[model samples]
Target: MKVLFSSWLGEVVDNRGKPPESWSDCPAVTLPDTFGKDRPMSAFIGWGGVVVLNESYDIVETAYKYAQALQASSCAKCFPCRVGTKVMEDTLYKILEGNGSDSDLVQLETLCGSISSNSKCGIGQLGPGPIKDTLDHFKADYQAYISGGKKRPNYHYPYKMTAPCTSACPTGMDIPLYIEQIKEENFAGSMATIREASPMASSLGRACFHPCENNCRRDNVEKSLAICKLKRFAWDYENTHEVDMPLNPNKHTREERIAIIGSGIAGCVTAYNLALMGYRPVIFEKLTRPGGVQLTGIPQYRIPLESLDAEIKFLEGIGVEFVCNVTFGKDETFQTLRQKGYKAIVLATGADLSKGMRTEGEDQGYEGYYGGIGILKKIKYENAEIPKYKTVLTVGAGNTAMDCCRTFARLGSNSYIVYRRTEKELPCDPHEYAESLDEGVKYMFLEAPKRIVAENGKVVGLESVKMELGEPDDSGRRRPVPIEGSDHVIEADCIISAIGQDPDIFYMGDEPKIKLNKWDNPVIDEDTMQVIGVPDVFAAGDCAMGPETLVIASGHGRRAAQSIDQYIRGEEIHLSDEQIMENIIRKIGAYNKNEKVPNPKGWERQPIPICDRDKKLSSFEEVELGYTQEQAMEEAARCMRCYIVGMACVISDSEGGE
Candidate 1:
C-alpha cells in the first residue's frame, strides 16, 4: 500500500516557533499517530457526523460553513439535489448574509428531510445533513440569523456520507493493498495480501458477487476496476508460475479444540483461520464431499472442483481436520460435541436447502418438478435424479437460477428462465446472465408461475401471469405486480423452483434446542456470532443470515473465529469501548514520501477472456479462460486505490464501519 504524501508537499510549522523541518526529516503521519498515545487533542472526533465540542467552540459558524460546503459539493444529479442543494446554499448564505427570514430556516429543514428520503443516491440523501445538525445543536444561531444578528463562534460538524463504498463491502478488504502490490508487479505479494484477509481468495475471485466492486469509487472514472478477476489472476499466477511463500511458523503450544459444522465457505473459512491461529479445528461435513453448497450447488463448469479442493487442501496443510459424511443433529449434537472435549462449536450449516414452489401439485408427488439447487447437486454428484427433460424451466433470476439454467444447457436440455422481474431487476451477476444467454438459454421475464399446469400429476407446463413493475420493494427492485386477466401458459417438460432458500434449522430436530428466532434463522448476536442463549455454540454464514454470498459468509466465518477464541478465553463476546479504541490503527500526520506508487487513472480495464461460446455450450467444463499474465498486470493498473477513503474513518467514535 502506498502512503500518499501529496497532502503535505509544502511547508509545515508546528506550534513551536522554531523553523519547521522538511517532510523527509519528519516521521510519516501514519494511522497510529492519531492514537494520541502521546498527542491526541488536535485529532478531531465526530459523533453522529458532528465534531464533538463544548461551549468554548462556536457551533453556528462551523455548521453554516459546512452546510454551505456540502451544498456546493453535491453532484446535483437528481432534482432534489440540483434544486435542493442550491436552495440550501442560498438559505444558509442569507442567514450569514444578515437578511434571513423565518421561512428560510423552515425551508432549510424541509429540504433536508425531503432530500434525505427521496434522493436517488448518497449525493442528495446526505447533502443536507449539516443543516439538520445545525437545526439541532445551533438553533440559537439560526434564530439569531432570523433576527438579523451575528454569533461569534460557530461549531463545525464532521462530513457525513464519507467512505460509503468501504462501508458497503462485506469483508471490508483493504482494496488498495493488493492493487498497489499488483501495480508494483508483485503478483505473489498481491496474492499474499489477499490471503492475509480472506482464506478463499481463488474461489472468491471466480464466484464472489464482489459487493466491494459495486461500491468502488473508480466507477465514477469509467468502469469499476476488474477487482474480482484480478484476484483470480493473482491466485492463478501463483498456482502455475510462482512458488508458494513459506509462512512464519506458529510456535505456540496451546491446543484448543474448535469444532466447526458444515463444509461450506463459512465452515471452511472458520477452520482455516482457527488453524492459522494454532487451534485444533475439527470440521464436520454432512455430505460425502466437502465445500458445502460451493461444490454441490455451484456447478463445476463455473468454479472447477479442483479450485475448491486446492483451498480445502491448503486448510488441511494448516492442521485443520475434515470429517466427511457426518450429520450434525443425528451423528452428533452439541451434547456429543461437548462430550468430545471441544471447546466451541461453530454452526456453519449454510442455507443448503432448495426452496419448494408451493404451487399446485407441488405438495404431492409432482412429476418433473424439483428444486433448482437439488438438481444442481444431483448434476454435480452424478445422481440418478439428473434432469432428463427436453425442456426445463428455472424459476428465479439469481445466480443459482443461472447456474441451473447453465446446467441444463450442458446437459442438452433447452432451458428457459421464468423471472417475474425485468432483466434490470436480475439478482444474478451480469457475467452469468450474459453467458447464460450466449448458451441459448431463453428468458421469459415479467412473468411468474401461477401454478404447475400439470396433467394427471405429471408436470407438462406452467400456468403463469404477466406482471408489471409498481413501486420499489424492500429489496429495492421494483415490486412485480400481477396484471388482472393476463394469465398465460408455458410448455416445459420440467420445472425447477429457485425462488430462494433459507437455512434448514429443522436439522436440529429438538435435541439440544439451539435457539432460533421467528424467521427460523439461528439467533446469533450480530457482533459476536454467538447463539443468543447457547454460550458454547456460535453460528455463521447462511445459518445466521438466511442466504448471503460467499464473501459475506466467509467474513462471518472470520468474525466467528475471533469471537469463539474470545469466549474460550473467558472474555466478553462484544468488545468494550476502550478495547475497540485501543485496537484501531489511526492514520494521521504527514504521509510518507517513499511509499507513493503510480497513479491508476485512464488505464483502460483489460477484459477477462471468456471461453468460446461454441466450446462452452458443448461441454460442462470451465467456461472462462483464466487471464494471461500480461492481461492481469494491465488490469491491475486500473485500480483507483479507494482505501484512502478508509483514512477518513480515523477519528470515529468506535472501530471501523463494515
Candidate 2:
C-alpha cells in the first residue's frame, strides 16, 4: 500500500524525496499493490487523481495516456466535455512529441477547469481532475518532455468505462446506458443493450434479486431508481407491442455442437450466448419440462410459467435445441458426449437438493414431512392437491423459505417461518420479507428446529430450541447458539425443512473426472468457469457456485460460454482488456455510500404497481404489475449516468512508445 506520491481527492501525500522509513501513507485513498495475479502496477490514474507507486515510471507519458483515455471515453454529450477533452489530448500529445513549451501548461490548466465546470457527466467533470493534479504535482516531468530532456517510457495503458451500478452488477450490465435509453423513449434500444449481457430479460426482470440498485448513485439524492422495474418495462414493452424478437444472424453457422446439461438460468444463458456466436447449443433437461429449478423450486407467483416459456421460445428461435427427460450420468456420460461430437459440455444442473436440518426424525419418511424444494416441485409441476393440514412450519430464512411459507398461506394454511436469528438478520430480500408478513405468514425468531415430532409415521409438531446470537461466523452473520433447557414444541401437522440446498451432481457418478469442493459443488477456475484439470468440461450456476442469485448464475454462464468459444477456436482462454480493467475498478471500490452527490432531491422514486393483496393471495399469479410507460420514463430520468473512466499503467515489455 505504499505510495511515492498521491493527490487523490486533494489528500496529498508527497514522499518523493523522503526515505522509505519517513514516508507517510495517504489516508484518503487505497489501491491494490498488484494488478492481475502478481503484475505490479506502476501508477493508477482515474476520475479522482493520480497515485504513483514506482518512481521509475515516466510521469509525462503516463499523464498523456490518461488524457488519451479520457478523450476516448467521452460520450460527447456536451460541448465542453467533447471539445475540451480532445483539446487536452492534443496538447498533451504535442508535449509528448518534444514540441515546446511553457505556455501550453497554462492552457492545459485552463482547459481542465472549463471541462470540470461545464461537462454534463462524470467523464467530463472528474476526468480532468487527474490531469490537473499531474500538471501541478508533476509539472517538472512535463517540462522535461517539452525541453527534449526526457525519453517516452514504453508502457501499456488499458482503460475501461464503468459506472457504479454497472461495476457492482454481477453481469457487469451497462445499467446507465439502458436507463438512458429508457429516458430517450427507446425501449427497443434499452432491450438491445440489456441483451448484450443477458438474454433472460423477461425472467430476470421478474425473479432476479437485482444487486445493481443497491449501488446506484441516485440513492444519494432521494432513493435508487427502480432499476429492476425499468428492465421489466423494456421487456414488457417489446412483448405487448408484438415486436418480433430479433434472432442472431450468425446462428447455427458454426459446425461444432455444444451440450448444456440444464435448462436453468445458467444453462439457458450459456446456450443463448453460444447460439449468438454461431455455435449450435443443445440443452438437456431431466424433467418433462424445461426451465429447471426456476420452474420447480421458485413459486409460480414470482415468475409465471408463461413468462419463462416465452423466454425459452426466444432462445429456441435463436437456434438453441432443447431435449427433455435426458439425464447426464445415466443417459449420457461426459465421455459419451464427446464421442457423440459435442465439442464442449456445460454442467449447470443447479443445487436443488435440500440440505438436512441435522435434527432427529427428519430423514424418515413421515406423512407430513417435506423438504422445501420437494414440496414446491409437487405443487408447481405435479399440481398436487391442497394439503388438509391446518398448520405448516417451515425452517430457514432465505428466499426459498419465504416462498414456501407464502405459498402455504395462499393455500389457506396457517404458515409460520422459524429462524434461529432475529427478523433483522433475515437472509431473504427486504421486499420478500415484507410481503410475506403482509400475507399473514407468521414468524418465530430466536427459535431453531430441534427435531421433527411425529406420531404413527405422521408429522405432528416440531420441537424447537430458543437461540441467542453469538460472535460473527464465517458468513459474517451472528452465529446462533441454543440456550440450555429452552426446548419447546410448535404443534403443526406439516413440517418443511428449507434450510439450504446443495448441488445434485449425483449425475456425475462415483468416479467423475471433475473435482468438487468440500461442499460437493464442482470446482472450476473462477475466472474461466472451466472445470479444474478438465478443459473440455465447464460448470456454472448452483452446481458450480453452490446457491446464488440468478444474476450471478447468468454471469457465470456468460463467462463460461466465452471460454468455451475460445477453447473450440484453439485460442488462449483469457479475459479481455476491458474485463481486466473491470476487475481492477471493482477491487478499488465503485459505489461509495458515504460520498455526497451534488444533485438536489425532490424527484421521488416512482412506485411500481402490484396485484391486489386479496387477489394475489387467492391464486398463484405474478405479483408485480410492472411500470407504465409514463412511470418508466420518469424513473429513468433520475439516473445520474455516474460513469467514470479507469486506466492502469502496466509495465509492458513491448518497444512501442507514445
Candidate 3:
C-alpha cells in the first residue's frame, strides 16, 4: 500500500517523507497529475511502465536517449534495430528547436516503421515505443511551443552539431543518447541503439579501432569517449543473457535470388543485408564451410568459432542460402550466373592467396615449406601434409605472419618471425602481435631472408641479413637497407612467406570484358561497385580492391549491395564515392563548429576475459575469451553518447520573438 514518486532529476520521495534504500523493492513510485509552475511537474507513470511526459526536458534529447538505450539493448541480429534506431536518433536531433522543420517528423515516422517491422529482437523492435507515443500524445503541445505559443527567449544563437564523436561514426550513431541510456540503466534499450550502425556488437565491442574515441568531446575534459568498448559491453550482455534473433514476418515473400561470392565478413554481411532486402541470397563459397578467412586464417585465440557460428546461423534463419564447396571462377563462371537469372552478383572473395618473396630459394627443395595462406589452410583443415617441424621461420610482420607464428606455436612447433624492418614497423594490429609474443613466438626484427640453406636437399637453416631503417617507402613506413657484413643464419626446418597478396584476377579471363587495375585487381566504379566494361558485374572485398581489413571489406560489401540493387532496378545511379566523401566532409564541417555537449566520466578500459597465456597455448580452444555478461554490462555503462540533440538557430532578438 506504500507509494513513492520519482522526480525527473532522479529524486525519489516516499509517503514516509524519505526514499527507501532499495527503491526497486518499494511498493510503488507514483506521480501527481499537476503541480505549481515553480515546482517540478509530476509526470504520470501509467500502469506497466508506461512513461507519461510532463516536464520541460528537451523532447529531442528525451527521444534520442530512449532510442540510444533501445539500440544498445538490441541483439543486433536483424536489419531494423541494427541500422534503424541509429538513423532515428540521428534524424530526431534536426527536429529539435532551431534546426527543426516539418520534414523531420516524416523522416522519424519512416525510421520508426522500419525498426518496428524488421528488427530482430524486442529490444530494438519496441525501442520506438516511447518515441511514437510521445509524438502521438504531444504533437499539439510541440506545435504550440514551436509556433510562438510561449514568448521566445533572448538567448544568443550558436551553431549546432559540434561533437566529433558523432561525426566520426560511420553509422551516424547517437553516441550521447546511448551513453545517457546506460547512465539511466536502460540496458536493453542501449543495445538496440548501438545495433543501428554496427551488427557485430560483440566483435566490435572487443576489436573496433574506435575512431570515435579519439574525437570524443570528453578528451577536452579528461579522457575520450569509450564508445567502442561500451558497445562491446552491451553486446556481451545481450549475447550472454539469452538474446535471440527474431524471425522475419515477410519470409514467404523472399522470391528474388541474390548470389554473393566469398564467405568472409563481407560476403556474410552482404548476404545478411540482401536477406533483409527480401531477397534470398545464395552465397557461393570455395570451402566446405562458411567464414572464409575469419574461420581459417584468423587464430581461434582472438575470435572463437562459437560466436562466428552463432552469427552465421542467425543469417541462415533469415532466408540467406549458403552453398559451400563451390568457387566462382572454376566451379561456375559469371556467364553461368547470368544464365541462371540471378538478379545480382556480389564478389566478396577476400584475398586468400599469400604473396611470396621474389628472392631466391622460393622454390628450394624443402620437406616443409609453405606460403602464409597455405600454412593457415593446412592448420584449419588439420591436413598434416605440412610437417610438424621442430623449428619454424615466418616472413613479414603483418597480421598474417603473426597468425601463422602463433598457430605454429600451438601445433608444438617453435616459431620465429623474421621481419626486414624493426618492431615499430610491424603491420599487425598491436593487440594481435602482443598476443603472439605471449604465446612464445620470437621476433627477429631488421632481418631479411638472403637464402634458404639446404643440407642434402632438405632445408636446414634460413640465411638472413640485418637491415637498418632507410627512406620512407610508398607505404610511408621506413624501408630497410641491408647492412653489407651483417649476414647471419638461423637454423629452421621450415619457412612460410607472408609478405602480402595480390588479387587473383586471371580467373576473370581475357575475354570477360571486365577491366583490371595495374595490380591486376578488378577495376570497379568505387561508388557503384560496378566492374568497368562489365555492366552487370559487381566487385567487392579484397579481390576487387587490394588487401584490406575485414571491417573495410564489409563496408564495400554493403555499398556494393546498394549499387547492385540500383543496377537491377534499371536506375541511373548518380551517387559516386566522391559525392559520398563530399557529403561526409560537409556534415563534418557542420558538426565541428557547434557548441560542445557535456561528457560523462570515469571510464576504464574494458578487458576481454581470457585464460592464462600458458594455459591457452596448450590447446586451440580460443585464448582471448569473449566478455562475460557482467564485464560487458559494466563496460556498456561507460559510453558517453557524443551527439547533440538540438540544433540552435541564430536570429536577432526581435526576429526570434515573432
Candidate 4:
C-alpha cells in the first residue's frame, strides 16, 4: 500500500521522490488526495522531509528523511522545540548510523512530551503530533530499529463508534447497554443496567416523552425505534415477572440524613437515588397521599395510581421514608429541618396553581368557574359533582384543558375547549387533543374568551370574540388578534381556566427567608439545582423550573440529589447551568463512535395499541398498551449498539479526546 504522511512542512512532497518547490509546479494536495479516501495508504510528512510509515516502505530511508526534517526546522528562540528538535535529529542520525541505544527511545518520548506541551507556536507545538501518533500506533517500527526481528502483524480495521439515541436520554440510562442486554434476552441484566442512572424506569417507560427516539439514527432510513416502549417493556417484565425494584448493591450506614420536600416525580427521584448512595432520604408531602402531580395533577387514565404506588413502594423498600400530610412551612421550616438532624433539604414542590384567563368578569366571583388543574385534582383524588355542571367551558389548549374536557365527557357532561389559537397551534400533546376529539369533546379555536357572563352569582355563559393571526409573539407562534364586532356568547354552566401556572411561593410565607427570583420562585444554580447562596438547601422540579414535563422534573430531582450529596460530602459546591449541561452531555455523550454503526434497515416503528374508544371513555384505564416480549426483542435488536461502540472507544485522555 502507498503511504503518504505529511504535516504543514510536508507541503514539499507532491507524490514525487524529490521535494516540490514552487506552488505552480506542484499544487498542495492532502495525503488522501494523493491516494484515495477508500484506499489502504498511510503517510507522515512533517515540517520537512517525508517519512512514509507503511510496513512495505524502507525504514532506513524514512529515518533519514525524518532526521533531515528535524535538522532543517530548528528555530533558535524556544528552548524546548529549538534544542529538542535538534537533539531528536541527532538521535535519528545515530539510529540511521546503526548505533542507536534503548536510552534514545526514552529520550525521544521525553522530548515529544516537552515539545508538545511547552512549544510557543503551532509549528513547534503540533510538530510532535506525528511522533505521538507513531509511538502509539506504530511503536513497533521504532522498536524494530532498536531491538531486532520485527514481523508486521496481520491487518485489523478499528471499529467506528456511533450512537445518537444514547446521548439523547436525559437520565443517561446507558441506552445501548440495556438494548444489547435485551438483544441477548437478558431482561434482568437489562433492568440492572438501566437502574445505574435512573430509578424511575417503570414510570419513565409509561410516560417519558423520549427525547432519545427523536434523535435516533434509524430515523434517516425508516422511523425512529420505539425506544420508550422498549424501556417500558423491560420495566414491565422486571416489575410484574421478576423480583420487584432494583436494589442497592452495596448497602452501608450513613450519618447524613437528607430531607427532600415534595413527593412529585422530581422529589421521589432525588430520594430514590440518594437512598441508593447509602444516605437516609426522607420525603415530606403536604397532601394526604404522596405522588405530588403524579397523583393529583395528572389524570388517572394517563398515569395509573397503582403504577405510581408500586414505584413509591420500591423507594420505601430501599429504606426511603415518606412522611405525608406534612406541610413544609407549617410543620417544618428550612431552619427546623436542619435542627431536626437533616443535613440538607431539597425543595421540589411542583407548580400546582392553575392560571386564570385574566379577562373581564374573572374577579367577579362567578360560581363553578374553577382552575383546570383544580378541577382535574378534584376529579383525580375524589369524584366531585362534575356531571352536575352539565356544560363545561375550558379556556386554554393545553394538556390540562384536554384532560378537564375528557373528564367532564366521561361524567356525561357537555364539554368544549375554547382556545385563542387554532388546532395547529395547540400546546397540548397531539394525541391527547385527538383522543379528546374522539371522546366527543368539542373545540372552538380562534375564539378568544373576553369574559364569563354570570346570572345570579353563577356562571351561565362565556363571552368570546373571534381572533385573527398577527405577527409572531415571544413564544414564536403567531399572535392572536381579536376581530372587531365579532363578539359572541356561548351558554355554559361552568368555565375552567387552564392558561398556565407558576411557582406559588405563598407557602414560603411573607418573611421571605431564601432568595427568590422576580417571579417569586427560588433563585437556584440551575446546573446543581442548589439554591443560590443557600448551601444546605436545593430546589428541583416545577418549582425550580416553572412547570416542566415529568421526565424533566425527575432529571432535575436526580441533579438536586447529586448537589445535596456533594454539599453534605464537602465537595465542589457551585455549578453553573452550563456545567450541569456539560455533566449531562458527558454522561450521555455526543457521538458514540466516529463511524456510523450499521443498524437493521427498513424496519417501521412498532405501532402502539390503545384501548377501544368505548372502553376508554367509560373508565380510567391505561390507554397505550406496552410492547410484547417478541416485539421488544425485535426493536431492541434494531438499536445498532451505538453506545457499545462508544464504550469500546472510551477516550483515556479526556471526554471528546481522540
The candidate maximizing lDDT is 2
Clashes of each: 12, 0, 30, 11
- lDDT of candidates 1 onward, in order: 0.70, 0.88, 0.63, 0.70
- Give a tens-digit lDDT track for model 1, residues 172-209: 45556687687778887887778766778888888888
The root-mean-square deviation over C-alpha atoms between each candidate and the true structure, in angstroms, is: 14.1, 1.6, 15.7, 13.6
lDDT, residue 320, candidate 2? 94
TM-scores for all candidates: the values are: 0.72, 0.97, 0.68, 0.72
| Candidate order (TM-score) | 2, 1, 4, 3
Model 4: runs farther than 4 Å from truth? 1-162, 242-245, 249-252, 510-513, 574-601, 644-658
Displacement of the residue 525 alpha carbon in candidate 3, Å: 1.4
Which tens-of-lDDT digit does each residue in 9-105 have in candidate 4?
3343223344333212323322332121132323333322233423334333344344344435444557887787788778765654557777887
For model 1, the stretches where C-alpha displacement exceeds 4 angstroms are 1-167, 383-387, 509-513, 576-602, 645-658
lDDT of 4 at 278: 89
- The 10-residue segment of model 2 with minimum total lDDT is 506-515
Superposed on all Cα atoms, model 4 deviates from the true structure by an RMSD in Å of: 13.6
